[model samples]
Target: MNQGVQGPADTGVPAARGRPAAPPAPSRPDGGDAGPDTDRERAADPGTVRGEHTHSERPLPRPRPAVQRSSVRGQVLDALRTALVAGELAPGEVYSAPALGERFGVSATPVREAMQQLALEGAVEVVPNRGFRVVERDARELAELAEVRALIEVPVMLRLARTVPADRWRELRPLAEATVRAAASGCRAAYAESDRAFHRAVLAQGGNDQLVRIADDLHRRAQWPLVGGPARQRRAELVADAAEHTALLDALAARDLEVVRALVGEHFAGSV
Candidate 1:
């Protein structure tokens, strides 16, 4: 969540950031950008002899210039990731870059670039002419990710609960409280972000950046929302989840390892 949520300055890209971000560049005068599905052309029937075929192949549509402000790419990537987590980009369904570009009010070039990065991260897979498809995971795979997170995070939390100074754990109260407020507000975007932030802060207590990063990756995968699930119910579930964070903080502050372990286990169970 933090990865693609930053401004251009954070990334050191020659891109604009802040309020009222720069407008997208205009389409090339050379007619490089495709104007939606209006330009669709039927493929020639290869079964027919070349001489007999009346259909001529249209040149592939050229994507606009790729020198877009990196902020655009960051915004597109964040929006795409939100769609994935919100189930708008259903797992296993093909989504075209041009279509998504139109949805985000930008050229297909930057959208395609963002999708390429998602592909590299295993969030989506390239589909050749079809664009990309969100990677699907079954119940077992989701559970496996949760288990890996617990394996990586729980021990560190256990250690920190007893060894960390009381003030250090107390210092994270605002982040934990933010998750609770977000959960109560019933906004998936707010809750999802605060949830990640809360866990990330907790994992950071371990003082191992690598472990925190690995656990954060697992946390993202494990929390990918289900397609066509009930939103109201998910909100309610988030409220219940926020309770776990409160309990975890309380347990850690009290240095109760047994309660902390149980709270962590229950927090991860049936998640995502």
Candidate 2:
């Protein structure tokens, strides 16, 4: 026993003298010694792992709400159509999807989709590898559209003038006033939409859905800017045109067929 057992001084260990021994240095997986600088680096880096079960201190990124693609496409389409009606998108000009998308603060995909819808409406045509070209429409084509509309709508309006009550026609006064306000704003697109609303209200009184649909389509075509036509229509002219809605409403309330026919004919003629 005396040969095998050693005293504290003979053992040569720090713990044997009642003092704690130094801990072993950490090592990397590759067996390299991890110094004080390595521990400091790991502590400084929020993304770095420390112990066996500890994770990074970095927070995850917040999730974003997704935007609806269809809503974006529809908005692009509406904006393009308004631009066309306002004559900002000139007839016979080619507009690339990338260029339009940049202008609208959107990606090219929605612009392309909107352009495709315009092509289907005959407002634009697809150009191979180029873009879409706005369809050039002449004064004659616009005149024809107006004439067809007059043919369909004048008779119905005249009929409504005879049968519809005065209160019903009075109810359309607000719609007519809306057109006036839109015209005063000097926005062609707004006036065009309000004008159509007034006409649609008038035609709705006739209770002919098919007739209204055809007339509405023709009215939209007639509103498009004509090639070689005035770049900007005079505000006075728009106001004058808008005033006719009120006059027609008055005539219908009074059941004055003669005045209604004259106003209706003159309105269509002025459209060309």
TM-score of each: 0.72, 0.73
Give the least accurate 10-residue stretch of model 1, judged by summed lDDT.
34-43
lDDT of the structure predicted as candidate 2: 0.86
Candidate 1 residues 84-190, lDDT tens each?
77677888789999999999999998899999988887789999889998887677777787788788778889999988877777888998889889988977767
* Candidate whose lDDT is highest: 2
Runs of candidate 2 exceeding 4 Å displacement:
1-67
Give the range where candidate 2 is weakest over 10 consecutive residues by summed lDDT.
Answer: 50-59
- Candidate with top TM-score is 2
